[model samples]
Target chain A: MEHEEAKKTTFWANIGNFFKKIGSKISEKAAKKAGSSNKTQMLEWKKDGWKATVCLAPALIILAVFTFYPILNTFLVSFFPDYNYVTDEFGSFGFDSYALVLQDATFWRAMGNTALMVIVSVPLSILIALIITVLLNSIKKLQGFFQIIFFLPYVTNGIAFGLVFATIFSPMDYGLVNTLLNAVGISSVGWTGTTNIPYWAGLFVITVYAIWNGLAFKILVFLSGIQGIDKQYYQAAQVDATPRWRVFTKITVPLLSPMILYITITSMMGAFKSYSSVVSLFGESMGNGQNETFITAVGYIYKYFNRVVHDNISWVLSRASAAAVILFLFILAITGIQMWANKKKVHY
Target chain B: MEKELYFASDEQAKKYERIRKVRLFFVYFFLTICALFTLIPFYWMLATSFKTAEEVQRIPATFIPLQPTFQNYINVFSGENAILLRYIGNTVLVGILTTIFEVIITILASFAFSRLEFKGRDVIFALLLTTMMVPGEMMIMTNFTTIARLGWLDTYQALVIPFVASVFYIFFLRQNFKQIPDELYYAAKVDGNSDFKYLWKVMLPIARPSIITITILAMIGSWNAYLWPRSVCVEADMKLVTDGLMYLFQNEVGGTSDHQIMAATTVVSLPLLIAFACFKKHIMRGVARSGIKG
Candidate 1:
């Protein structure tokens, strides 16, 4: 009787298990059917590879438009001869643009101008900024006030600042600066008009502005670098009777080398791209006496394009393109040298 | 102990204290001169703005305008210079919009960069870093053409769109984001939350400082933008403060006088300068954060 009862229970359990498996399968199928409405949902559930590719589409498109296409266009334009941009013809490609760019005297002159500005202005600004920074770092009273004044230039709109400069330095006697000079025994100098003085004047004013502007940030950076130094070193040095200058030279300068390199590179770049103010001061002609002051690699490129678009100097585009390529190469070489030199100085 | 070490005797210490006082005086003297050099240009702009046309051009210069006037300031506010307000509005709108879009895009991209174990991520980031070398000047021609093709010339679209994605900001925010603990990301994952929700809820609030820094940077860059705005918005109505100031500088229309130009410049710059001063702490913090790497 017991054996027969146990057999009956096993038979009932088997029947229940079979029905439970079918019900679970039906629910699973129903859930899958509900999720299959959108192609995205279907792919995500099944095709992981396709999901990733679709996800990356926006970023990839941005890269192509902003990075790849522009670089490719720059290289392609350099190879093509002067063609009507409107006509969209593939003019003869050779070293014609390169040859013309290389042979042009004005191109070299502009290169010289740009190089001069970089060589002269960058170091001056960086050095002055360091001195101002060091001084600010040493001060204790009204520290915030001093910092704000020094940093004013950094936040000042370069274009608006340029306007102020242009007005103050305008060549006309009615202009404030020229008027002041005349008030003295000096004759009115064309600060942005004539080549002999205006270029140097422009350089001086712009450099001052750059240095003043550069002071606050670099000061703060150097201050942070200074603050980070283990004060124990100074305390120990004092016990050893180390001179103040010696300690600074040995400890601070080496520690700040990395930041110095950054400042140098940025300053060099800043000098190369000093256009907003230059344009404001020199007008559309760029104080180049019909192309003289206007001959900077950047200024020239700016002028040519502005002219091409507005005044129909399409021929200048090839020249401008050629100048731009050379300018890029110039920057690459200088920055490469700067980095190579500074790399050894970086303290681990 | 420090005081004793400076001088073995009280007499010596007394003399040293006097010398220290003298040194402090000299240091302040030098600092004052430096500060003067920095402040004088701004003072001159203000002083010149207050002077009459003849007073501004006066011999030996009126260090303080003898006859102070609000005439120039009035002219700047008047309708003859209506473009000034338009320029301000344009700049504010561009700055705010770019900051908003960029912050959102960058937060998402930075999160992806920080947490996700994606293929070729480092390589992609490395390529983006290389683009930093491609100076704005190198790409100006192409950017201009692109804007023209988009039929966005003389419009704010040309000024704002190309710069909406800053590789530098993405890289910066990514570095900040990576420093966050991984537990939060995984916790969200275990809860079956999407990546977007995880970022919006957990990651963004943690990265507030960096977000603020980038926002300040983007806004300032857009606000002070001169060349791009000039290139794109050639139409009079599309002009910004920088361009408007340039126009005023070119035409000298605010009374055919030097004082008027000075006043207009002062007016244009005053808003930015004041805003900068008010938010000086925030800006300095942002600058210091970036300067750490710079």
Candidate 2:
């Protein structure tokens, strides 16, 4: 932890030094331009200096207004004990929102569901993607054709494809999966409906959808990483007549570790923020009537933001902000741990 | 040269050859199965879209539409679902405007960071990088409040403005920019060219591929954005395609017709599918580059 803290501080310090150096350079240039009585040279120097700021202004302003400001505002709003979102009124600040969020069972369920998604979907997607990529690498013909087919999912809009998935996994007897099951003498299952299906089944469907949707990109990345591996290693293995599985375990995996690490961190983050897939699977409520069976952290945040609780809009708003903060912290902690773990194990 | 290769005995070689053939067959078998799995959803979506409502609901579902019809497609563009066209219009407008503004700002910001020397350059860049780590959901409530305060709710500005300045795009473009040799900039300076002139005339043209990548990514992102647009654009006419589809499913029909929903989905996804087909290499390469760098 101390080492991490030191690394963070040093990062900031480097930025500080960079700013200082630029500051001195700008001042020195200004001094030289001022010393020169030539009007055009001074104007030229001034124009160059102003040009940089001009280029940066729009991005800085927009990012400030939209990104940074909102983050800080959300953090602050999470503390407000009684904040009216519509009226822009607030009582004295406190930790009531955070406390309320922590005490709420729904919040914990959302966190648990989000964790379940990340744990189940991320690794499963990676493993499947790796297997497919390795298989893809072995092929000499129709490689591009197979790649395009695999990557089709990554291009299509998630929600749109998700709508397709909803139908395939539809709880009705005629649904594709159900039809297949029944054709083999099994009964139809309620994948999404007001009743009949287990809650976990719906969550499982969503997880399966998530893993499938996520595979395209991971497969693409791993394919490229695998293809980029030096042919010499493979040739040497061939010369040694090393077994294919051994070649994969000893060579392909280690070489592809960096890409694997990259995919894991990103997919985990994406899974935690999983929203549209659930919406596609279970609709806006993320579950059948009156059941919050599959609420994710982001979905929970959206639910509270839209719903008025106890006829108190402020209460819902503050609670939503609190939930958002918790989600952020959860993501942050996971990413940090992943980075540390990858640092120890990943090969470049 | 070697007295005899260790594994080169005739019987052993034949056995190894047989194993290799078996392994190769399994590899093809596994790949074909996986590819089918990947393509099935797309196939089902398309197949369902063309099927009649009754056919879609038939048990032992037909893999091919028994009677393919354009009725669902027609339905999507008429009746209560006619608003879908408006949603598509809204999305196109947002995508175009957001891409233009986003690409321009990203170019300017990236050019400045990559090529121009200025005070606090790295500091500001580092600060921007930190923002990338913040989850978009965490900022949604606050951004929504901010939009509401601006009286921009349900407006195109609400959808386009907040997303116009992406740090990731700027970072990606900057990486591309830094690859151009510094000597060229000095040579341009020696030719009495202004910084902006050189940037517009020389640098941008050289960095066209990255610029295209940014444009494609920005457009796709804007097109696919659902949550923020759904929240901010609550008006019936202001919804984007995904949000509009959700609205259609929930409000208009209440999850009724699989055929109609699939039809609407196909309509929404078709453009992206076409674009991907046309620019598959560029998109794949861009994604790979960004993923590796990121």
Candidate 3:
């Protein structure tokens, strides 16, 4: 019996050796190509330069025409005092557009509304996501099931979902929220229509929609971040009989800081650019008359770009460019500040 | 003889086990409630889509449709709403083309940045990365003007070309590519294999996961794109799904009814929902990988 077992082991070992020989031969070829001599390595490096340029050309050309040129043009156009859209002429160079945008009351309101959205929605979404992620991590089964259900909103078209949200918050008594409110003997609230709904109520609906939409990504990230934490940490905590809240604050939060920072910056930037969700809620006009209360920064920029001023199209163009530049600068400043503040805080 | 485990014999251990069971129950309860909140809008969308106009307008809205009908869906796909089906075709065509070009461009760019060493490579990469910080909204006005100048507006090129090369995607794929050992590239070279050949045979196969992730993301992004498509595709024939639905809503044919609007939404959203259901694991991994790496 011992002799038979030795024969079988030798057969398996022979197969492994055969595969090992092939692997070593391949690595030997690799090492040769890598070159042992300094002169040959220099020659290869020179060849790589041409290869890199050839490979990068297609993407670089497209990006230059569409991305890089457009960015430069936006900045240049913002500085043009009298830029003609139809004829493509720059009459003069000045900061007239910037001054007009900064001094405009509507611009300030838009900025305030954008700020409110980022402030309210980002933290709320993160907190809820963190709690849900913790709860999800504690469970051993049905985790994947719950994750799919939660992530449904993330995959669905945001605008279509926003439309569904609009229906639920519809001003009529038959709307979902109103119907639920009525069950508790509360009166129907005009949650959307600009006619009677308070500006705050409209903002409230937008905020809720944003937070709900934002939750899926944050939860996914936080869940992964939580799962990535060493299991031994939790085991050790349990051995010490650590309280649940204590473990969460002391262990989870500190470890998950990098993800927290990422979610905060990205969501805040997203909130600043909130347009389609607001459009879904308020429709094309966003709000009635000249005082569009619910307009966001990007929405404000879109409004100016599309706004027809007849013969003064140049003024509108300049203003739109200025608004775009302001939004860009604002994002840059905020991201810079966020990175600086969190540099020391993020665990990674 | 069997040995008794010390904790297994204690009354305190039993008490702890009971508490743990109760805690587990609460965890499930809280998760279920949150899951309902997360899922209710989708449920409402589906339920409303099937309900009668009167049912949708009924006071104390029905949790489930009392009289579900396919009439709304039928209306959406036939008659005045038949245009929506054409719009879906436009979106799918655009989506597929965008994915093809995007994946190719991203792979080439990422491969160059990852595997090839050249002078000013880091500088060029940094310049590319900076473009990501420039929001799409800022670029749209200028891109619109550029497209109009080139006479590409209202065409597939306008929708597909500008977005074909994404810096974010290139960055993602490059990170994946960099993980591949230098020895593989060297070995391929020793065999007299061309860079493109090696990329096709080895690097691509090894980095298939990231490529798949990029393809899925790009496809979804193309489908969900609204503002840019809405801006360029003004012609009725050129309208994509989101733009078409918005146009219909604004025009108010069957759009006035909540049920009909819900039906349109359900139709628009169904493809993605089905895609997600079939490839949930891949989609989740892609999203999680991107998030964690970022």
By DockQ, the best candidate is 2
Interface RMSD, all candidates in order, equals: 18.8, 5.5, 13.0
Local error of candidate 1 at residue B173 (angstroms):
0.5
Query: Model 3 misses residue A316 by how many Å?
Result: 1.4
Off by over 4 Å in 3: A1-42, A288-290, A308-314, B1-9, B251-256
Clashes by residue pair, model 2: none
lDDT score for residue A120 of model 3:
88
Per-residue accuracy of model 3 over B1-294 as CA lDDT, tens digit each: 001223646797788778879999999999999999988898888999999988988888898999889999999999688899999999999999999999998999999999887766666876776676677767887887788778886899889999898887887788789899999988998999999999999999999989888888877887788888987778899989887887877433212388888999999999999999898999988877765553
| lDDT score of residue A80 within candidate 3 | 95
- Give me the runs in candidate 2 sitting further than 4 Å from their true place: A1-47, A308-312, B1-16, B251-256
lDDT of all predictions: 0.68, 0.80, 0.80
Q: List the TM values for chain B, per candidate.
A: 0.92, 0.92, 0.94
**TM-scores for candidates 1 onward, in order:** 0.86, 0.91, 0.91
Pairs of residues clashing in candidate 3:
none
Each model's DockQ?
Answer: 0.28, 0.48, 0.42
State, as a TM-score between 0 and 1, how close model 3 is to the true structure.
Answer: 0.91
Model 1 Cα lDDT, one tens digit per residue, B137-231: 66776666667767888987677667767776776788788888888878898999877787779878888988998888787787677767777
